[model samples]
Target: MTIIGWMIVFCEIAFWVVIVLGLMTRYIFKKKQLGIILLALTPLVDLTLLIAAGIDIYRGEVATTAHAIAAVYIGISIAYGKSMIEWADQRFQYYVTKQGEKPRKRYGIEYSKHYFKGWIRHFIAYIIGGGILVGLIFWIDDISRTQALSGVAKIWSIVLGIDLIISITYFIWPPKEKGISSGT
Candidate 1:
């Protein structure tokens, strides 16, 4: 095998090691990191196939052993990132409340006078974060250099906008208070 193939294998191995370490210890490095690492090392793996198997993964010509390994890395990474994000979010809520002053409790629409402050602002803020991530993908990758970006673009446009909005709104604005008064 060429150095590129070896590099792919090395990266794959590193991904697993990080995941195991996270699970056993901190558990922060998962899904996105996994995907990022896989994508980061994809060139190496693709190059190996180009050199050894005479196929180009970037051009979508062939699926080699490295391709399978890359797929696994993405799948596992997505799972890991999601798990980590959720874990971190829960802990973050606690940490913020514990260490910092709590924002005034969300009472009702009456108390929240600003337009969008209660509901819409929460959604917009979320989409903003997602939009930022999508923008990152566009800036970091060779969009024209690789065919894979089309898929990335398609997925991000939809999920990034909606999921980000939902996730952020849930965390930031919080659920409606059931029994509290806005104080008339």
Candidate 2:
């Protein structure tokens, strides 16, 4: 793997470690302020990856799949980080601290709405990440250097389209709730 690939892996690991530490501090140790501080630092990991990728490109290195993926990772982190943190916090609160109710499971129309909302988040991530790839392609100003990023963008675009189709199907055929009858 390239340096960018290693950096991406490190960033992912750092993000989760920071999240767990933040949650542990908040719930396990009862240090709310410190926990918030640690949680807020999650973005730093993304920033570090972004800077590393930028520096690599600035050094005249050709952009690789790893570099494109770094953009996607940063975009996803920015778009979903808060919700992910909330998700983890809810689980920690319910299972570890025992202070809140268990997270509720959605069904029927509610599940469809949830799925749709997730698709919207994915769209946002695509825009942000794709925007970065385009910007990098222009900045590099060489087709040979940016082919990997363009390929990633094309693949991601297809994935987004497929996701939209699946999400819409959730609305067309909403999931049935357990133990509920359709009045047949």
What lDDT would each prediction earn against the true structure?
Answer: 0.43, 0.96
**Candidate 2: what lDDT?**
0.96
Clashing pairs in 1: 30-81, 31-77, 31-78, 31-80, 31-81
RMSD of 1: 12.1
- Listed in order, each prediction's TM-score against the native is 0.28, 0.97
Candidate 1 lDDT over 1-184, as tens digits, reads: 5443565566656544543443323323445455444434433533443343223443433333443333333333433444443444445445642432443454444343432332343344334433433443354455443333345435545754575566555555545688756456
Which candidate leads in TM-score? 2
User: Which window of ten consecutive residues has the lowest lDDT sum in model 1?
Assistant: 45-54
lDDT of 1 at 149: 33
lDDT of candidate 2 at residue 178, scale 0 to 100:
91
Task: Compute the lDDT for candidate 1.
Answer: 0.43
